[model samples]
Target: MVAGRLSRYFGRRFLGASLTVFVGVFGLVLLVDYIELMRRSAGEANASALLAAGISVTRVPQIMERIMPFAVLVGAMLCYLNLSRRLELVVARSAGMSAWQFVAPAVIAALLVGVIATAVYNPIAATLQEQSKRLEDRAFNNAAQSGLQATGTGFWVRQRSVDGQSIINAASSTDQGVRLGGVTVFMYDLAGRFVERIEAKAAVLEEGYWRLVEARRYPVDAPPEKLADHQLKTNLTLAQVRETFATPETVSFWDLPFFIEMADHAGLAAAGYRLQYQKLISRPALLAAMVLVAAAFSLRFFRFGGVQKMVLSGIVAGFLLYVLSKVTEDLSKAELMHPAAAAWLPVFIGVLTGLVPLLYLEDG
Candidate 1:
C-alpha cells in the first residue's frame, strides 16, 4: 500500500511538472514562430495576421516534437530538485526508498508519454505541417513570377513509354505533385535523340498520361504547335508522385512503412523514412533515459553543494544529446550511416551516460 501510494505520488509530480514545462515551451515557440511568419508575409497581399498565426500554430507541433526530449529532461530535473529542496526526497530516502525506486515512476511516465507522442501526436502534427505548407504556398502564390523560382526550383521526373522517353520539370507542384505549374517537358526518341519540347501553364498527373494545359509543342523539324490541352503518354502513378514529394517530417509514423515501400517500388531512396521510423521506435527508450539523466543531476539534496553546477551540467548534457542526434541524422540522410544506427546510437549513448553516474552515486 505504501509503495503504491508513493509511486502514484511520484508519478503525479513528474507528470505535472512535465506538462507545465511542455506548455510553457509550446507557447514560447508559437509566439516566436508567429512573429517570424508575420514578418515574412508582410508583403504578401493574401497573408493576414490571422493566417500567419494559423501557420505558426500548425508548424509549432513539429518543432515541439523535435524538442520534446529536452522538455522531458528539464521537467524531470525541476521535479526532482523541487522534491529535494522541500526535503520530500530526503524523507523518502530516510524511509528506505532508493533513488531508483522513486525515479522509476518518472521513467515509466516518460516512456508512456513517448509512446503517445509517437503513435498519436505525430500523425496530427504531420497533417498540420502539410496544411501549413499549403497555406504558406497559397499566401505567397504571386510573390514570384517564376513558379519555379518561388517554390525552390520544383522537381524533375523521367518517364518512359512505347512512344519513347520524356523528362518533366515543374516550377511548382501541389497535392503531392498531382498538379504542377510552369511545367516543361522534353521529349526524346527511342534512339535517345532530342525530338520535341512542350511548355505548359500546368500539368495534371493522370492514368498513364500527363494532361497538359495551354501547351505549346516545338518539333525539331517542324514549326511549334499550340494546343489548349494535350495528352502526353507516360508511366507514373499517384503513389509514386506523392512519395516523391513528401518530406520525412510530413509523413506520419504509421504511414512511414507504407511510404517506404512505395519509394522502394518507385526506385527512390527511402533512407529518410527509414530513419524516421527507427527514431520513433526508439523514442520511448530515449525518454526513459532522459529521466535517468535528470535524476543523476538533480537527486542531490538541497543541502549538498554544487547544486548550480549540477543543473548546468544537466542542461549541457541535454544540448549535447540534441547535437549528436542532428549529426547522426545528417549522416544517415547522406547515406554515410545506416538509418537504424543513426537513430539508435544517440539513445544508446544517452542511456549509458545516464546510467554510469547513477550507478556510482547510488551504489558507491
Candidate 2:
C-alpha cells in the first residue's frame, strides 16, 4: 500500500509538472509565431490578425509535438528536483524504495503522454496545418471564390530515362502518394529539347512504372494525341513517390496502415510511412526512457553542491540525443539503414543508458 501510494503521488506530481511545461512551451511558440506571421503580413492587404492567429495556432501544435520529449525530460527533472530539495527522495530511499521504484509513476505518465500525442494530437495538428494552408491561399489569391485548388500541394519530382528527363507535377495525392490526380509530365530529350508533354487525368504507380489514364501526348509542332491508356517507364518506386510529396509528419499514425496497403498494391516502397508508424508506436517507450534519464540526473542529494551542473549535463545529453536521432532519420531516409532499426535505436540506447546509471547509483 505504501509503495502504491508513493508511486501515485510521484505520478501526479510528474503529470502536473509536465502539463505546466507543455502549456508554457506552447504559449511561447504561439507568441513568437504569431508575431512573426503578423509582421510578414504587414504589406499584404488581405492579411489580418485573425488569420495570422489561426496560422500560429495550427503551426504551434506540430512544433510542440517536436518538443514533447524535451518537455518530459525537463518536467521529470523538475519533479525529482523539487522532491530532492524537500528530502522526499532521500526519505524514500531510506525507507527501502529505490530511485527506480519511485520513478515508476513518472515512467507511466510519460507513456500516457506518448500515446495521446500519437493518437489524438497528431491528427488535430495535421488538420489544422491543412486549414492554415487553405487560409493562406485564400488570403493571398482568389481561391475562396473558385474553391481552394491543389496545384502546389505536394513536392515536384524529376526523373531521367533514355527517352528524356521527365518533370512531374502532381496536384494532389493520397497519403500513400502513389495515386495522383491532375498530373502533368513534361518530357525532354537528352539535348534539352522538348520531346512531348503527357497530361494525365490520373496516375497510379505500378511496378517499375506509372500507369496513366486518359492521357494526352502533345508533341512539339504536332497535334496532341489522345490515348485511353499510357505507360511511363519509371525507375522510381512507390517509396520514392511517397517521399516526393507526403512527408512523414503530414501522415497520421492511424492512416499509416492504409497508406502502407496502398503502396503495397502499387508495388512501391512504403518505407517512410512504415518508419513513421514504428516511431509513433515506439514513442511511449522513448518518453519512459526520458524519465529515467531525468531521474538519473536529478535524484542526487540537494547538498551535493552541483545540482545546476547536473541539470546542465542533463540538458546536453538531451541535445545529443535529439541530434543523433535526426542523423539516424536521414540515414534511414537515404536507405543507409533499415527504417525500423533507425526509428527504434535511439530509444533503445536511451533506455539502456539511463537505466544502467540509475541502477548502479541505487544498488551499489
User: For every model shown, what is its TM-score relative to the native structure?
Assistant: 0.89, 0.77
Residue-by-residue lDDT tens digits, candidate 2, 51-157: 88886787688778789999999999999999999988878777778777888889988999899989998888866665665565445432222112334454367
Model 2: weakest 10-residue lDDT segment is: 141-150
CA-lDDT, candidates in order: 0.86, 0.79
Kindly report which residue stretches of model 2 are placed more than 4 angstroms away from their true locations once superposed.
142-154, 157-244
- Which has the greatest lDDT? 1
Write down the worst ten-residue block by lDDT for model 1: 142-151
Q: Give the per-residue Cα lDDT of candidate 2 at 46.
A: 89
Residue 13: error of model 1 in Å?
1.6
Q: List the residue pairs that clash in candidate 2.
A: 238-268, 239-269
lDDT of 2: 0.79
Report the error of model 2 at residue 270, Å: 2.2
